[model samples]
Target: MKIGELANRSGLTPSRIRFYERIGLLKAVDRKANGYRSYPAEAVTILGLIALAQGAGFSLDEIRALLPADLEHWEHDALAGALTRKVADIETLQARLARSKAHLLHVIDEIEARPDDIDCATNARRVLTRLLGEDAEMPVASLRAKQF
Candidate 1:
């Protein structure tokens, strides 16, 4: 099929497909006598795999290294190792995100726990102190005057 038909079948824009070709992610396509790009039926499957890898956070360079021009020649051990490493990276990111979420919730709890009798400025100062620690170099008085 031609580039347009390939793009339509693959659910990617023609320019994107051309960009992939330029970046060496997609192998060189055959050209017809009329100078139109010719793509094999397997191109659609390859494009789908590329999209899946990108959605899973693999960079184009990584995908290029992981995927061979011909799927039949894929190295099973290398592919498995790369997938395992990606899973570990994702797990580490999840842990960091969890910590960030917990810290945000702690900050919210501290800010919301202010006594009703305390003024906003004093409450802000108290929250800032708890957040920054008592020995923080930044002045709490100035921070309290600024809106959150």
Candidate 2:
């Protein structure tokens, strides 16, 4: 198939496919005598895998690492370990997301409880400081105003 055909089949843009090739996430296809890019049927599966990896929040660099090495040279155990670690990382992300959502809800409740004239700038600073310690970046107004 041509690049366009592969792209259509993979549901990825030709430019994105080209970019993946350029980045080493996807290998370049052979060119025809006319100098047009000629993709093999397997390129579709490779592109689909790339899309799946990206959807999982794996960076292109990470995806490159995930690519299977020549089995003749690389051990299957290494790939298994990489996948295991990826699963663990995803679990950590889910836990962190849940915590962040809970914290945001708490902030909303605090904001709602504050009096109108008083700025919550101080409260914001306290939250930031508690989360990031004294080294947290804070605006000057956060020190003076109780509300913002």
Candidate 3:
């Protein structure tokens, strides 16, 4: 099938399909004598795999590693490795989210318990700045140094 047919069948743009080929995700397609790219019937299945990988949050580089030379005989190891890495990333993100939530709770508490006074306002502003990482920035338990 021509690239146009593949695009219609796979719902992928010609540029994207070509890019996948260039990036070693898709097989290099055969070209007609006129230099038009011709894909085999199996291209649809390969493209489908690429789409599935994207939906699973695998980067192109990761997907390229995960795709097997023979789809029908894919190894479990590749899939396991990819999933393990994704799990690690998710764990890191979860940790960050916990920290952010903790900071938000602290800010709410401060706002609720703060005394309305000139000295208190200055101290509160200083604390916020510290959490956000001011002058010489470094990660601190407080979110004051963070820029929202």
Candidate 4:
């Protein structure tokens, strides 16, 4: 098939297909006498795999490393290792994000729990003291000047 047909089948733009070819993600194409790029039937499947891998958070370089020049000779061990590492990286990111979310929620709770009589500066100081240690003394004037 031609480049247009391949792009249509793969659900990618012509520019994207060309980009993949330039970046060495897609293998070289055969050119017809009229200078039209010719692609094999397997090109559509490869493009779909590239799109899927990108959606799964794999970078183009990472995808390139995962895929071989010849689709028939895939490196199973390397692919498995890359998948394991990506999962571990995602888990670590999730843990960090959870911690950040918890900290934000705690801060929100502290702000909401402030007494009616307490001023904004005093509440800010109290919240800051709770977040940081009691040893960290921030001036009420500075706290009042800053927005949340």
Candidate 5:
């Protein structure tokens, strides 16, 4: 089919499909006598897989490396290894995100624990001390300068 029909069937924009072709990801394309792009039926399936792989955190380069030259043939060991590595990367990211979330919660708790007796400046200092330990002793002017 033509680019428009392929885009409609694949749920991808024509520009995006052209971009994939430019980047050497979508290879099953031909130019007809009328100088329009023609795509095989398999292009739709390939585009779908590309979208799914991107959603699953596969970079375009990674997807290109993983895609088989022939659809019917895949290097099973390579595919399995790449997937295992991606899982490990995701687990590491999850651990880091959990740590960041815990730190943010701790900061929120400190900010919310302000005593009525203390002024805003004092409460801010107190929260900063709890959050930053020894580093919180730096003068506010110096902290402001460092931020810039």
Candidate 6:
């Protein structure tokens, strides 16, 4: 089929299809005598898989590495290993994000706990003390020197 039909069938833009072809991800394409791109019916399926993989956090390079030259044959063990590694990577990221979210929530709570009579600097010191221990009481110049 033509590029337009392939784009419609694959739910991808013409430019994206062209980009995939250019990047060596979509290999089952041919050039017609009239200079139009001709794609096999399987191109639709290939494009779908590429999109799915991307949604699952696979980079284009990773997808290219995972894609078999011939759709009929796959290196099952390699595929399984790569998928397992990706899952682990995602889990690590989730844990880090959860910690970051919790830290932000804690900071928000501290900032909101300011007393009516205390000045802004006092409240800032109180929050910093709660977060950074006695080090929050150190002089600004001392902190700057310590940073280096």
lDDT of 6 by residue, 29-95 (tens): 9998889999999999999999999999999999999999979999999999999999999999899
Tens-place lDDT digits, model 3, residues 1-148: 9999999999999999999998888884898899999998889999998998789678998888888876676779878987998989889888989988997898778666656664776767756665454543444553354444
lDDT of all predictions, in order shown?
A: 0.86, 0.74, 0.81, 0.87, 0.88, 0.91
Best by TM-score: 5
lDDT at position 85, candidate 2:
84
Give the TM-score (vs. native) of candidate 5.
0.88
What's the TM-score of every candidate structure?
0.86, 0.70, 0.69, 0.82, 0.88, 0.86
Pairs in clash, predicted candidate 2:
119-146, 119-147, 119-148, 120-147
For model 4, how does the per-residue alpha-carbon lDDT over 43-128 read when each residue is reduced to its tens digit? 99889899999888899999999988878889999999999998998999899789878878999999999999999899998988
Off by over 4 Å in 4: 134-148
Evaluate model 5: give its lDDT.
0.88
lDDT pick, better of 5 and 6: 6
The lDDT ranking, best first, is 6, 5, 4, 1, 3, 2
Error of 6 at 146 (Å): 14
Model 1 lDDT, full chain set:
0.86
Identify the leading candidate in terms of lDDT. Answer: 6
Query: Runs in model 2 with CA error above 4 Å?
Result: 69-75, 115-148
* TM-score, model 1 to reference: 0.86
Report the CA-based lDDT of candidate 6 relative to the real structure. 0.91
| Stretches > 4 Å off in candidate 5 | 137-148
Scored by lDDT, model 3 comes in at 0.81
